[model samples]
Target: MWKVVVVALAGLVLAGVGGVALAYPSLAATTCPGCYGLTELSPGVHVEDGLSPAQRERVGEVADQAARRVTAFYGGRRSSPGLLVCLTEACYRRIGGGQERGVAVLNRSVMLSPRGLDPVIASHEMSHVELHARLASSAEVPQWFDEGLAVVVSGDPRYLAPESAPDRCLVAPSGPLPVTLEEWLRTASADPATYARSACQVSRWLGENGGRAGLLGLVTRLNAGEPFSALVRTR
Candidate 1:
């Protein structure tokens, strides 16, 4: 029953991830009983588990596997300084990763638990990290685009639903999807079904177009600071 969700910097905006609080407690304001620095397991993959050395190793193995999956997903097109996967309650709370965001990727790192670490979750956050690496700014990316692409690239099962059309690549649980991407971001996350809908729509878009090639072109344009509206016309 523990389906994974990834909260991208958009806090699900990027990976269809959602729900925890927005504020991050100062690092100094919080500390784990057995605080430890993140350990580098594989290239650009890090893990910090306060439980035991054996647990740390286990988490590291999972992270390494996820990292490889992510790299392969993009066909080795992207990377970052590193990725941090933590398994400390204190760290989770401080970073805002609870039921709302069990697996989230923030500006500083990616937060995860052994219970939450899966290929889908890991790859979703990895997509966000790589996108940010490309965008490289506070440059806004539409929530639907972010979350949808994460779900698509992560190969999450929820995205298997075959939506009808590429033009239909938009959703809102209520009141008609807002007029603007910004407005959609403000409203879409409120609905619990947001992630699944987004994944379906995005998958449809990728399929209707030219698969990864089309996706990469769109990503490149977005990184160049193109607006999401330019790619998908919504009236």
Candidate 2:
């Protein structure tokens, strides 16, 4: 009877592991990138199997450009995170991608779906990585500011006017901007234009402050143990 009970417990543990792997395959991929048959197209860029030489070249070029843009905006450089690119829907889903084109996995890596191959999308995700590297914890900043800063840095024309002032509101939000990640996700799903609204508000705030300098200052203060609320009182 004791032997049977031990076997049952082992089976339960295996089942739980399988469940988690299915729910979040990205965790497995990050843990062992080569397990998914990903090949390094460059120093830090990994591509799913079956990607052609031209496709690999494109990914490398786009990632390089994105990194440069982010570095320029931040006025400093952070270590490049692993970039995982999936060229097919199956690969994307296998690596835990959903409706989103791209996602930043903390400050460690960025995963890109087939549709997220553009420079703007890559830069947007990398912006998240940059901010995460700077902060002791991502929780230090609000969700709106996080996404908004990405939009601004990526120069996402969808949310902001080209060559226009960043403070100008383009698309009105459906409601109040979300402060937390959960609320931001819910509001974003309900109204896709929440990104524009966030960008608008952050842009306005940056304008009132010192622009990129203000952002760096704010981050410095946050790192030095200053409250985000007191630093970003304009918001």
Candidate 3:
């Protein structure tokens, strides 16, 4: 079993990630020969050939819907045209050369598992894109918070189980909230509760102040070079 690796960045966030860049190989370059073809079902969505036209349309619909949903909640600063999404196991694995369920690149390119193009996954990946669009390349975002927000917004049920309060280290009174956002996320693993904890913390903060607007404000502050942990410091 592959442990998920997530990274939250200012302009390019990735789940099950290694790093940045949208340099996927062409569809014809997949390691699995003759296993993939590309189709443009919508202005900005490219799907692999295994899906029928109807399935491709549905995938595009899901992608568009997810983009709208995430941008609406996180703000519309996302200016990218759209994205490239893979829909086959061979294509997903071959494009990014990874076994992680999903991958999002800086150029708005996404490699999704065959069974992973549903609304939840669609929304989750788009969340990264929208948030990334709003972020600066140097912003400080915790991995847990990044993944949590995506999961909650996507309505992904697995991590929906409410997480108790965040760790004391995250919320307890401290001398200037420790700046561990980068290191924590860089090393985070596939702990289901970690996502829930992030969701809980961010959701709680938003709930306490403003909802979507609050989230947008946080993005703005982050873009301005303020660490998210500092801005949301409980004490």
Winning candidate number (lDDT): 2
Clashing pairs in 1: 12-17
* Candidate 1 structure quality by residue, lDDT tens digits, 125-158: 7677776666647456666667767776676665
lDDT value for model 1 = 0.57
Query: Positional deviation of 99 in candidate 2, in angstroms?
Result: 1.2
Off by over 4 Å in 3: 1-36, 75-77, 161-190
**Candidate 2 lDDT tens digits, 22-74:** 87788767666787878888888889988788988899888999998899899
Question: TM-scores of all models?
Answer: 0.65, 0.87, 0.69
True-structure lDDT of candidate 3: 0.60
Off by over 4 Å in 2: 1-20, 165-168, 172-175
Candidate 2 is scored at a TM of 0.87
| TM-score attained by model 1 | 0.65
